[model samples]
Target: MLRIDGKKVYLVPFEEKHLVDPAYYAWLTDFEVVRYIGRDEYLKPIQFEKVREYVEELWRNRYCSFFAMHHSGDDAFIGTAKINYLNEAGFSTRTADIGIMIGDRGYWGKGMATDALFAICNYAFNDLSARKLTAGAVSANKAVIRAFQKIGFLEEGRLRKKLLISGEYMDHVLLGCFREELHPVI
Candidate 1:
């Protein structure tokens, strides 16, 4: 459970203990927080224990590397980020899918997501030997799309009406970044 230190937030390996705070479930149940998240079940309120068990299970999963995003200054829990290895049978495969969520409403629009994304990109490309990474955002999730772009992910394509949010279909913006495409931040 090593920590990846970044400018605004640092990523720590996900632990079951992280869910001790009821706020984690609170954020998951928040409409605005889960609005852009792809899961349809997340749209409805979820019980705290259910979400906790899900997170705990994630920690035990080998294909996914999850981290708790914490604000640097105050050590506040802001959200979580993860990179899922796409081809489990092929250990040599270097492709993965990246995802992030700034569940804390107060951190939205504060550039924290960009920082977290950068940290994960570095961890994936540099540490984990990932050759390429991919991610998708609901087209309406402008902030997340911008964060991915800001961190050097290029627009790969779009999936039309890929996600159903609030009974309406929204296009999913596909993005990707290669190890060679990453530009070192000054």
Candidate 2:
């Protein structure tokens, strides 16, 4: 179990307790935030149930990990971050991908994402032997791109028409960072 903490934020292992909250459903239903992450519709209880089922499967893996982000003020849960694709084959053994979301729109532009990324990556590299990380952003989202860049991820390339969001195809911006070259801004 990986635990990273700060004055206002902390990251903990994703658990069944985290999903028991009703706010998660509200966050998953928020169109502005879910526009880039979820399918066209809002995620219902059954949907999150499925997510829980899938996550439990992930927890049984050798390297698979995910965290539930929480705040210190209200102790309110904000979002989640996941490090999947934990295979031992090839160079993957040294690398782990990252994905995050701040479910509370009220916390937007407050550097919570930045804080969470820094804490998560620090734990990943030093604690989990993670050497590299990557994240993707759909064209409809500029905040995700900016957040990734703030963490020192450079624009590797764009995957054309990779997502169908808001009823049309959208492009994907691939961003990455490595242990040898972690971006300071991150």
TM-scores, each model vs. reference:
0.93, 0.86
Worst 10 residues of 2 by lDDT: 37-46
Alpha carbon deviation, residue 166, candidate 2 (Å): 1.4
TM-score winner:
1
lDDT of 1 by residue, 87-116 (tens): 574236788889998989998888898888
Name the 10 consecutive residues with the lowest summed lDDT in model 1. Answer: 85-94
How far residue 24's Cα lies from its native spot in candidate 1, in Å, is 0.7
lDDT of 2 by residue, 143-178 (tens): 877877886777888989988776789998888888
**Candidate 1: which stretches are off by over 4 Å?**
89-91, 184-186
